[model samples]
Target chain A: MVKEKEHEQDAEAGSYPTGQKPKYGPFDIRRYSPTQESKEKRKSNVLFFVALFAIIMLAVYGWYWYNTPGGERQVVQLKNALAPYNPATWYMGKLSQAQDIGNVWSAGGGNETLKGVLFDSFKVAGSEEIPQGSPVVFAYGLKLANAVVSKLPLTLSCNIKDKDIAGDIIPSNPLIISGKRITQNARCRFNSEITKELSGTVEVEGGVIFPFSTTDAKLKVYFTSEEMEQSLLSADEGDFFSYLGIDEQLPLRTAYNGEPIELGIGVSTENEQPVVLREGYNPLIGITLNNRWDGKMLNLTEFRLIIPKELSINQEISQNPNGLCPFTLARQGKTTNEYRASEELIEQVSLEKGRLRSFECWLDVAPELLGSAQYTVKEYEAEADYVYQLPSRTATITVKGVAGKETGIGEDLLSPLV
Target chain B: MGIKPIAIACICLVSLFFISGCDMLPNSIPGFGGNDESSVGGVLSASIFAPSNNGKVLSDYPFKPIVKIKNAGQFEAEGQTCITGLDKDVFSVFTGCECKSFKFEKEGATSEFEPISLEFGSYTVKPQEGDANQQFSAITRYEYVTDVTADLCISNDIYEDCGADPDAGGAIDAKISRVSGGPISIEGVQETVSYTGGSDTVTLIFTINARKSATGRLIPESDLNAQCTPVSADETPKVQAAVREFPITTPIRCRDAEVSADSTATIICEAKDISLINAKGQAVFEKGYTVPITFSLRYFFETVASSKFVVS
Candidate 1:
């Protein structure tokens, strides 16, 4: 009976009576269950395993996120680190007023000497060549040292030494200071006109204090450009004098010396024709004079217009030579037949330096000499004598005469000669 | 084989939950990844200031080097940005770096520009070999963003507002003078007069540059306005060639970009041998008088600079 009870217990526990097969339906499969204590032990083991796995996984992924080679984190770190980048302010040379001193002269003052002009080391910094005709900036730094108790205003000046650079100096601002030490900035726009080296001088002026002396500085350097050399203004030599000197003597007939002046000689008539004289036309000629001396005045004595032998003058052309300043012309000397001008003419007119004066005269052509359709020019030597301060000079002009039919004279003179 | 299907499924689900739960951890945790698109905050500055480049350097010798570090940007924490404060762990740097590591708290803002004495060990150099100089780069990495603007004046009326200081350009006050070449006329003014001075030409200088106040080290990004353009930390401002137009214009072949720390750039436009008749359908500037020139320039400018340096 005890054995039978143990068998029933095993059957109920699903151990199947120590490996005996249980009877089941066609598709049914045999199953087993653990004892209460074993079931509890198994459940505990599963729970422990799950917890352990979770811990291990946490550690692995943690390591991966922390030490991943590259990702958004790296990019962010780089960005932040580079955030404080500073492109340096483009500047050169020391910022002191007296970094370099040049020729400082001081007049007697309460204590300090009034300083002369000073030069500092102000300059542009770089190696890149600037182009000609292109604008470039010449920046510099300045420092002011004031030893006096009162405030002073300073005019910091910059000058481009090379004219070819065509530079225009532009100050960043006026510098007014009362502090012991202060810095100032300035720039110059160098409008380069040539490819040659460029240089400039910077100066500090106008800081005066009774007991304290001020120091000014300037910078000098050659600025190079990459532009091709440009064409320069012509420097041809021309007539340059300061006194009223005769430049050229031109006559209406044949333009004996050069082309006739635009206005007809004497009274300056509009569209005056060629100086060829007919039986009744007036003959006029222009004498051009210029004062080449810059500032000196030219004083004169008596003036004479000598008549040549071929031209017969029975009387003075005019008692008062119109437009011949302060002078009256009249027949003088019977044998020589000279036309002498009044001394007052020379006294009344004085040519200022660089002044241009034109003297035109109207002379009558003897009517008896015009008989042919075209007359050959008669060459004659004429002279103008004048007494100027320090020197008396004579100017001679050749006069050619054309007396004939107006049409025929044009052929010989290449222009109207009446 | 004895395990129930439902129990197995439950175990698998639990495992998956643990694996995916990592995304929920605080960003401060080492393994958790955060949003990649979010902007980072922190301004780091590190640069070399001494031992300027002089074409060549002696080899295998110690040369004086000047290094500097500064907090050029605000520090952001917990979605708040502070200019004067810093984080506890502040910043970390390697000890072996050429420039020694230092903390902002100890160094302070006043000392930001103070140069640190450092030494650079030279290397071999050769002119014939076309060898490059031994470069020294100090990279200060942080997460940051900035906005910058640069104003360029194209017209005469608003030039002062754009960046041109009136008194700064001494004697640059342009006045018309009748030079010998040709006649001159104001764009729309009547009674045109001929220049009688020397040449029939005038030099028109367009002083185009960022405002004097705009040029400097890193400035507050928010201070920028419409005249300014926001540039990435790594970019710089450049003048667009196609958009530049001078009144009596000339070709601008170079200086197309603003220098790193330049306050202004100059463009020279000249009218040479100009004719009495308006050529190019533009009126000539009169002599002995002041004529306003309207200049239009287009440029891209950035106020923020990434880690950068200069040869002393």
Candidate 2:
């Protein structure tokens, strides 16, 4: 009855059943009534979750801000601020401002070494033998001392002493030099002490021509440097100055050693039109060099004569002591043969102005050119190169052949004959 | 608080970032903002459409070589196309002149759609002992004119403000408005305004330069025969330059312009005693007026294209 009464009391207090105990300890009153400590724990948990959410939001916002254009611009600004530390950047900056120093020097007296203009380099580049009726480009390089601060307008004019070779400088405009430096040292100091190179090409059309082989070409570059005193029209005006006084000319003679020489080659045969050749007959071929220039005499450095392979030289009649000229023969290619004059012989061939030198040789036509056909016409080619004259003349000869039996008639004629 | 609202907010932020990123990318996709015209700006562009390079053709058969030309720039073009390197002994003789003349309209927005083609008449290759490879060059010489107009600010008073800041030396430079795109371009113009005391006239000097690129050779329009061949030594490349229009009534005189070996020509135009007073007898010096100067340069430009074929 007492147990039943206790159960009734437990049920009235809303506790567990008679035999069951509470989940917390017997003194744990907080199960039935909320405690201050429990409330504090709940508050702390809520704060922790809120703080975690806030941290996550802050991270997302930070990533978005970093990816914006403004962030990229800040990065660029930082790089630009540190660009001065890079050597390449420093050098490039100095190069871009190379012309700016000219203004500074003009305002103040420049270095004494830069007082007068100086030509540093002058070079001529072209082929030794310039063809006739062809444009000859005279590539020249001019280096000027950095003495003048203002823009220097230079006019390049050329004159050929020989009237026969008429040439005019193309684009007769003046070359403007606004303190552009082609070469610089590590320090990038642009001044007269460091020569600045200005290279340009001056084409003289019809500069080298036929008949007028040798020419005394002179190139004159004219420029003026003067200190000007002018009042500024306004603070926002460009430096405007006029050129005063006569332009000074720097003459450069293009004639190296003596004068530029042009050589011409002519090939002739004994039988003129439609050269006829037989198995027994030998033809005489003449190679001539006409020095049309009326200038200094020059030695023939080299000469080459190429003939078709179907023909062989009559060495017995064309050798020295009896032949017109001494030459050594060699096979050139599959279808041609080359004849070159000896070094000593070429050195002795000193051609005076307006002179002609001829070398003659006899060629024995081979039966292979006619093959088994009678009265066959074949085109044979012969060329000559003298002193590296490029685009050598190629003479095409139509050979009319009559197939004839081998004959010993020309054997006696092969004897040394001048 | 429920997590659903926070999740939605995060998704919206991520979506906004991606949308903005797509906007920052270049609009290079086709059908978007791509241009149809050629990127290379020039008067004329030519290519060998027929006789494909390194292709083979039968001997003793007639074939035609065609060249496709396009007006790539904003100018009309007329030129002669010459075919070279065709061996005469190995091919049928080309009657009449070898060069064919063609004219093309100026490039418009849809000009790229209409490319002109030139057919070098039918030619039969002669039979050879064996197969031979031949190389051909199609040389096009076109006459093009580049017109440039620049607005210059002229002021009699030294203190009158004009264009940009004064150059390094306090000299005002002419402001160029437009330069037609072509092989030849006006590099820049230098203007000088000189005034003498008590003189109502102001001297205006303009230095203009015509520069050509390395792709073609510039020849004088007068030398029409030298178009398809190597420039003769006697023929200097010159441009007929004229000051077509000027603001003032004073006549402008331009010097003869010759193209240098560097493919550059400098022309100087001067107008002396240009009245500072208007026709209404009003002084125009108190405020600077813009003077539109127009320059027209006429010259012939030559470019070459090469193709190879095997006659088997």
List CA RMSD, all candidates. Answer: 53.3, 38.3
C-alpha DockQ for predicted model 1: 0.00
Error of 2 at A343 (Å): 30
Tens digits of per-residue lDDT, candidate 1, B86-140, equal: 0001111111122133333325534332322233332222221222223222222
Candidate 2 Cα errors over 4 Å, as ranges:
A1-418, B1-39, B95-97, B106-113, B163-171, B197-199, B225-230, B279-281, B285-288
lDDT of each: 0.30, 0.50
lDDT of 1 by residue, A300-401 (tens): 344444432223432354334544422333564322245545565555545443344455455555432222111111222223332222111111111122
For residues A292-399, write the lDDT of model 2, one tens digit per residue.
Answer: 333223455555555556666788777742326556775565545766666677666654443455667777676554332211222222232222111111111111
Interface RMSD of each: 43.0, 26.1
